[model samples]
Target: MFSPEGPGLRELAVQALSSVERGYDLLAPKFDHTPFRTPDAVLDAVAAALTRMGPFGNGLDLCCGTGAGTVVPARVCRDSVTGVDFSAGMLAVARRRALPAGPRVHWVRADARALPFAPVFDLVVSFGAFGHFLPRELPGLFAQVRSVLRPGGRFAFPLVAPPRPGSPAYWALLGFDAVMRVRNAVWRPPFVMYYRTFRPSDVRRELTRAGFRVELHALPEFGRRRDGSPRVRLVVARRPAR
Candidate 1:
């Protein structure tokens, strides 16, 4: 359990035993209370960054769990905003939390690997959901994102810098990934979350291969590490202007 309002240990155990969609369905109501939800500070920083780069016409929130990451688009997009995810339970929670009206918020249930929309969105963003996707999925995933965007459109997300070896954060993430590996080994319909799967270099390469121009912006709000590397950075991969 993360907080008084969060799901308890027993509840979490039950969730872990279920399929990923079902697990989130079980956890959806209490998800925001947990540390797993994207923090408001990160969201605010991203919103600020987008405000400077935007006046975007439409936006999409990829894999928008509980719609916490989806709200940023509603604020900056002029036409419409959509949150798409594979989990119906997560979408249900998002629907409840989303505003009644304004720029037309819609929730579409679909896998990110094969997005249904045409060249629609001007900007797209995701948060705290990458671990769910394996490295091999990146190419198709990036391609799908590219397919959904218009010329010069963007797909952006916040990524924390990998923890240095010998650091506490590094070991902690390693331990978590190791445990998840063991859990999936014995469990059916693997949950597919690994902390170390997505490296920035590999991601950039994949994005480039998928036909996007990639750029990074340091999120200075999180400050720098001992080596002066930013703690967090925004990955902005743009579809070509042509």
Candidate 2:
């Protein structure tokens, strides 16, 4: 599942044994080479979707690892964009890479659970970071995202539909989660990634409870499943204009 430039078995083994932050810190240099990085296709698709929904003012990229999500906001937002994450190493890599300078990119080191911003953003997006948050953390996490967004602003992310029960992908994810559980049980500072935990129904319900008006938009690029459901969708949750 990794490219030739992605982490080797030894590197992955070391990372799995370390804390999440330290693991990511070590992996950050090679992250873009892995399947772990959000694909450019997804990012482009999301940017297009947001463009149709916006003329957004300022944007925030929640848990913006290496600033990929930040680029989406920079494309769509007119004024400014902020990429926030707790990882200094990740932020360092992001800063090294050239992003559009006109929009005023600001990198902040902060936890997603407690964002360091007022209700100033017209758009906010996160990419591939939800698996770090447990189910119980959704309310507070969504609340934090809502808190940073201006009234009538949006928090958007892309979510792929789950694999079929007997599929190879399904079994692979199941095996991964099982291994993660065992690792966490025996290790310190758990690397929190589980494939099956964040189901669409539960996420939609939690987002609604967190005061977002949730909508699902199919991303035609990823095509459809056998059941005629979308293989991928953009979850656009708007904060009420109160």
Candidate 3:
């Protein structure tokens, strides 16, 4: 699941034992080489969808580890792109990573729960970072995102269908969340990544409660599951224009 340049078993063990911020700080250099980084295909897919909804201004990428999501706005947004994450190490790598030619991209070191901005962005996007937040944190987190967005602004992120019950993928995710729960129980400053906790229904309800008019856009690129459900769909939540 990791590239040759990725963190080793010993490194991963050390990271897992550390607090989330310190763990990411230690792992930042090799993060992009790991499966933990959001894939380029997903980035491109989001970029395409944003292009169709195009002509946005001043974009923000929440929890932008290594700035992978910045590209989505760079192509479509007319003003600037800002990537926010609390991990300085990750932001360092993101500051250095090359991006496709587009709007000027900047990095900000800040927490998603307390962003340092006004309602200024036309669009916001996050990728593969929700697992870090517990269900109870969604209200405050979504509110933070909402506060930084202009009216009618979009807050989008992709959600993939959870694996089928009894499937190998399902078992894998179950085991991972189980292990995470145990680790948090025994460890200090928990890593806070639980894949199963971020459900579609829960997300929709939370976003609605946070005052967004939620919409789902099918990302047909990943194809559908055997059950004929979309394998991946983009959640686009819009703040009220008024």
Best by lDDT: 3
lDDT of 3: 0.92
| Candidate number of the best TM-score | 3
Q: What is the lDDT of residue 28 in candidate 1?
A: 90
TM-scores of the candidates are 0.97, 0.97, 0.98
Q: Given candidate 2, what's the lDDT at residue 111?
A: 92
Which residues of candidate 1, in runs, are more than 4 Å off? 98-101
Q: What TM value does model 1 have?
A: 0.97
How far does residue 169 in candidate 1 sit from its true spot (Å)? 1.2
Candidate 3 lDDT by residue in tens digits, 106-164: 89999999999999999999999999999999999999999999999999999999999
| Superposition error at 225 for model 2 (Å) | 1.5
What is the C-alpha local distance difference test score of each model? 0.91, 0.91, 0.92
Alpha carbon deviation, residue 75, candidate 3 (Å): 1.3
- Determine which window of 10 residues in candidate 2 has minimal summed lDDT: 95-104
